[model samples]
Target chain A: MKLIVSVKRVIDYNIKVRVKADNTGVDLANVKMALNPFCEIAVEEAIRLKEAGVASEVVVVSIGPTAVQEQLRTALALGADRAIHVETDELPEPLNVAKLLAKVIEAEQPGLVILGKQSIDSDNNQVGQMLAALAGRPQGTFASEVKVEGGKVLVTREVDGGLRTLSLDLPAIVTTDLRLNEPRYAKLPDIMKAKRKPLDVKTPADLGVELKQHITQLKVETPAQREAGIKVDSVDALIDKLKNEAKVI
Target chain B: MNILLDSIEKVVGSQNVLRGEDVRSRTADWMTKEPCLAGAIVRPANTEQLSEVMALCYEANQAVVTHGGLTGLVRGGMASSDELVISLERMTQIESIDCVSGTMTVQAGAPLQSVQEAADQAEMQFNLDLGARGSCTIGGNIATNAGGIRVIRYGMMRDLVLGVEAVLADGTVVNSMNTMLKNNAGYDLKQLFIGSEGTLGIVTRAVLKLHPQLTATNTALVACEDFNSLTGLLQHARKSLGGELCAFEVMWSSYYSLLTTESNRHTPPISSDAPYYVLIESLGAEQKESHERFEKAIESAFEKGLLIDAVLASSDHQREKLWAIREDVEGLAHLLAPRFAFDISLPILEMDKYVRKLQSAVSQRWKNAKVIVFGHLGDGNLHVSVATGDASDETREAVESLVYEPLKLMGGSVSAEHGIGLKKRKYLNLSRTPAEIALMQTLKIALDPRGLLNRNKVLPDILA
Candidate 1:
């Protein structure tokens, strides 16, 4: 069985991003970028499956500009057999990205596909479900744990209230949540070998998918700074201020 | 104390002062959870206000303790019950970043991480970095002359600092903020304040020298068979890496095994069974060339029997993983609770024999003692941690004597990068000659004649 894991490059979680002056989006110039943390969990799940002998090969796929190949290389170094880079000037919206991934799924015919529940940048959480709908496959999203047995993948999802288990047939879609697995660091030797691993590049045109935008970002502004609170001398002063100044007592 | 607080409030606004329970609620330092017992915590927003507060303290002969991030293991920043804590918490501001000159002027209270971030924003690198970077302040780094992982290449905090502005204990402001690379005009007075542990003066601001950001970083964790091979590997790495080498951290087998076997946390990337592991990192301009050279050096080292096995990090994540193993000092403390940790410096050639003697001495004292050793082998600094499942004052004294007593004969320093704070003040003479100690005392008495600044720290009381 073959497994396909999807990854995305995003700003490092540790960094404090600044808003651009024009407010179109975050100013990413001269910022550190890493593999999307949730996507790392997804890639780790796929590698674990391969290591468990439930899967033979793991192919990591990324849909973005040339710079996103860095994330693909990271995935490869973390144990992916190869990488498929869907080259595009700008990444399309979730529905269209699902259409393009559906094309790759049809072409590759993998037994299972794993993706992050949501990228930290967008937080859309739509691509995996849309891809499953386009490919006519069952999806076990937000999977905290995943196990493959008897041509089926058992996914334990982290629901709002508690755990929810579901068994999906082969050729299913799974979106990994944070508790899925901890990703391993790419070893130095593996990183050197990842450079030699095959990375096939394709375009949306080659997949016969036309890009369509369903949403337009109007402006991106940082949240308003919190007002500093004043310290009251005593309980009496606090009550007096709340009653007289705040007028909410 | 109340009258002194009132005078301090006149210099710095009353709102800036934290008193009574507020001062007592805060922890003394990062190493301990004990509630601080200072009379008050005075936070001045700027250097001028700090000088004013210092002037008041001098007039009253009131003892003052300067506080940075307080992450130091030594009790340098610890204040007594009556002493007032003059904290730089409010002075945290990066005043300017000179891109052309490659220098930054920052207030002392700014965290090292914030300074590093600002340097990153300017596309420059601040070479002084350590595990406490996020918590440690620029003032603390300057005061202690912090020697971190990159000290092998960038030298200590002393080398990274261009100029410093400090307030003398008597409230005199000394402004020698020179940013030039070479200014041999007169005495470099900044050296007097740095590494002085706030006994001479309180650092308020500094002009820090920055380096051009190195784009390429190559890191590896390699295994060596024995101490000789480890030293040989260091020589080989330095030769092959040349000026690119920034860090050469070595971990003994015990330290490596302890850090890795946590299993649920900090998974080891390679086998921890190796006798020694060296985390080598190099920074350069050309990524491909540096990576190739790093790999070639490792290959040659293996061929020369300097390394038994090695793993190189191909990406930033991998590099961070290799560093995490070395930087997990807190985990080391947890694995050996109530441990007596020593940071000592000796010649590289004497390290193996010193460890053997120390090991034998420790085992003779306690048959079941567990000792873990690791440090920046490049700078000849080793951090030795000993644990014997006993936490008593007498046991601690015995352990400290055992560690520092042997170093005197070995011509090694009892305190390496960590200064002679309250912790190692008793053993100052072990590492210093009588003449050297006298000169240090003369300088201390001349600068802080009242002995009110950081009292009972750095210099022993007997010297006074």
Candidate 2:
């Protein structure tokens, strides 16, 4: 089966997020950006599937600014086959991204579509589901385990309490979770080869997808601070505080 | 694929076979915003079932990925659509807690918080801790060799783990769960899988070493004029508190100010205006002496002019409040659009200069970038975050080179607490020798011959 993994270029999670002074959006003027953490997992998973012979080809697709081609190259370095960069300077909302990606899905018609559940920068965990909806395909989210059998996908989801199992037919959209797989590092040679791989860039106009704004930002403020409390002198005092003041017990 | 499913169903039963929407929930990890792409997820209740699943996967040449608690900072647990994932979620029983031996034998899927609670119930202590303790698993901790607050006293996960039970690619179970503290066995095979990030083998269970519960605890926040004073204060605390000193976390002024800002959760215990702050803690068997010694150490440091100001925690509430400033990094998330969190280590002698150089380099590269530094200074580990005004690949690469290049020249590790998950893989050679990396690959090839177990993770691509 041909596997197509969709990745995104987002601000690295380790970096602190800052709101713009004008409250227009996040200040991304000089921050470090990389492939979304979940997308990296998607790339890793596709490579593994191809290596195991379960997948014939693993293609990567990204819908973002022209610079997102770098992220596509990263996926290629980690072992994706070819890449499609839906080039646009403006980042469309998840729905628009899903729309553009849906076109690519329709064109390539891979058996499976894998993407990150949410982008850490935006925390909008809706793209994969929206894409699945737009593509009219079954979807799985927060998968801890996945297996293929008889042209269907079996996924183990981690719910709040315990594990829940589900199965879906082929040609489905699956988003990645943290516990699904450990992504492999791109080897130096792969990095060089990725530069030579086929990276086809398409414009939003070419794809016939309109860029739309879905979410508006008002203001972003720092989280509230914790209050300081007095330290007691003895264990008995600590016990007293826990019992009466803090009331954790 | 049908044969693989039949074998898995035989091992785990049809009830545990998850697919579709269930697959999506299981596919994504804690860090990723993506849904799971796995073909299926299998939960084995015990090592035997897991072994059987591995055998089937090996026969089918199916790619298998192992899932723990999914709390890793790096994207290690994300699975693909075609690969089969083996989650240890069903194998979470704490088999035994030996109070006398101060050891706990547990299944790999046990949450770290659960282990800590079990140790507490048994009147012992499991010293490993991190922000994700509530969700991270013991196996994941062992895989990442996670380090946290108590690493100053107890060391990393590698030290806390005595022995582990793992299954190789071909269903070979290597049970080396040693309970004793001093096991000078051949090769120390457990080390290979401890921080391999589940590339070599799937850890099934483990025997972890524990410590006697700390009866007396004392905490204090001390202000230092500079790194020299901070080092002097650390030496004083160690000498005075002796083996009782459990934590000595240093916070640079930038971090301290950020934590104590008007909008933050905690007010500064000291002035929050100091150039450097050290949050010190001592845990011992005697409460009175522990407090007395802790107070005396700070008093002497003050007398010696090494300390600018000191606030002793006379109560547990105060202690936690002081620690909140150092431990609560989530609050500072709003300072920069893209924050580059780096956990790098250098020799104590060179750390100050190295940090200054890092700051200078970051400033030179991005004049507006904010460099906030802090960490377990006692352990030669520094947690740095460079806030780039704009989030871009160029800025990320520039920041990484600025922070990592100094470590190569200073004989420091690229990663001190965090493992080289895909993010830091290229810089692995900064601290490790070429021969060392080669040995890692040799071991990887030996254990996972097909390179299917977390393939392409820690070791660089050998074919390259």
Which candidate achieves the best TM-score against the true structure?
1
Q: Best by DockQ, which number?
A: 1
Residue by residue across B1-464, what tens digits does model 1's lDDT show? 78888988888989888988898889996666778888889999999999998998999999999999998888888898879888999899999999889999999999999999899888899999899999899999999999989999999999999999999987899998999999999899999999999999999999999999876777888888999999998899889987898999999998998889743356787887888999999888775577678877887887798987777664476678779889998888877887988899988889988888888998999999988999999899999999978979888898888788878887899888988899998899999998998999899989999998899898878532
- Pairs of colliding residues, candidate 1: A188-B312
Clashes of 1: 1
lDDT of the candidates, in the order given: 0.89, 0.83
Provide the DockQ value for model 2.
0.01
TM-score of chain A of 1: 0.97
DockQ for every model, please: 0.21, 0.01
Candidate 1 chain A, which ten residues in sequence have the lowest lDDT sum? A183-192
Give TM-scores of the second chain, every candidate: 0.98, 0.95
Q: Which regions in candidate 2 have their CA more than 4 angstroms from the true location?
A: A1-249, B1-3, B26-29
TM-score for each candidate, following the candidate numbering: 0.85, 0.64
Candidate 1 wrong stretches, greater than 4 Å = A9-33, A63-70, A85-100, A121-124, A192-249, B1-61, B79-85, B118-125, B212-222, B232-244, B262-265, B281-325, B462-464
Quality of model 2 by C-alpha lDDT: 0.83
